[model samples]
Target: MKKIAMTVFLSTAMILTLPISSHAGHANHQPQESKELLYQDMLMLFLLPHIDQAVHDFYAKQLTASPVVYPYQVEVKKAERVGGSRSFHFLITLETTPVVGPHIPVGTDRLRFEIDPTLPGQVKLIQFEHLKSHELPPRWRHMIRRPEAIR
Candidate 1:
């Protein structure tokens, strides 16, 4: 929980500071973001809340004796602004492996977000795809069935 809180705080700070950072070159110059850059930024903001959950889910499925580690990677494959609002569409790929499975899991999830720049706290997830491409191992399956097995 603390990790997630810290991640959210950091991501929020980074996003909020991007405009300032980009315009730091000259006092009179204001940075203008290209459409692509804006889209990428919006896509990143959209994915921020999900990163910790993805990591947690990835670690929970592992049945190995080795210590669990951050096992997932998220990549933004494509991003586009929708209409004129601060809404965006995204295509993201998440790659990881199940804790006990021998196979690698790769999932492509589509996401859409509506961001109100003026009211940053009102950012909303318009759409989400919970993508999972691999079956759990026997041990994990058993643990999943018995909720108490989860610590």
Candidate 2:
């Protein structure tokens, strides 16, 4: 009787634990790599059509005014694909200017840019509400307008 009772108890315990172990195994499963590729595709589609002459014109003006620091390094921070479209948030790090004159010093600026699939390829500058005191050049300010407001 004692032996039978012990065996029954062990069997019930094993049965209860089996499902929990299986669930943990499922959690370790790898996500598909294709999801990332699909996201890139969506981003390209949304931006290519929305980026227009106005956007280019704005960048050109900035370049003309500040040829020394015209080009910016764009880093894509996050990208997501939803409903056949891609959205992206990126960071732009302005190249530091070389120190000039006796008292002036070179400075660096970092800006965040957001691109929605609705306006693909076109990036809009978001005002850093937290850093309201940071001063950016006029050209940079003009370039920060939304796609619809560019013209």
Worst 10 residues of 1 by lDDT: 63-72
Global lDDT scores for all candidate models: 0.47, 0.38
TM-score of each: 0.35, 0.24
Candidate 1 per-residue lDDT, tens place, 35-102, comes to 97676556555556654444454444542332122223345544445455655532344332223334
**Which parts of model 2 are misplaced by more than 4 Å?**
1-67, 70-105, 128-151
The TM-score between candidate 2 and the true structure equals 0.24
lDDT of 2 by residue, 1-151 (tens): 9999999999999998885434345667887779756765554444332232223333343332221222212123444443453424443322222112231222333333455445544576542212112234443544333433222
Which residue pairs in candidate 2 have backbone atoms (N, alpha carbon, C) closer than 3 angstroms, thus clashing?
46-120, 47-120, 47-121
- The candidate scoring highest on lDDT is 1
After superposition, the stretches of candidate 1 with alpha carbons farther than 4 Å from their true spots are: 1-46, 50-72, 82-108, 119-122, 146-151
Cα shift from native, residue 35, model 1 (Å)? 14
Instruction: Provide C-alpha RMSD values for all models, in order.
Output: 21.5, 15.4
Question: Cα lDDT for residue 77, model 1?
Answer: 46
Residue-level error in angstroms, candidate 1, position 107: 6.3
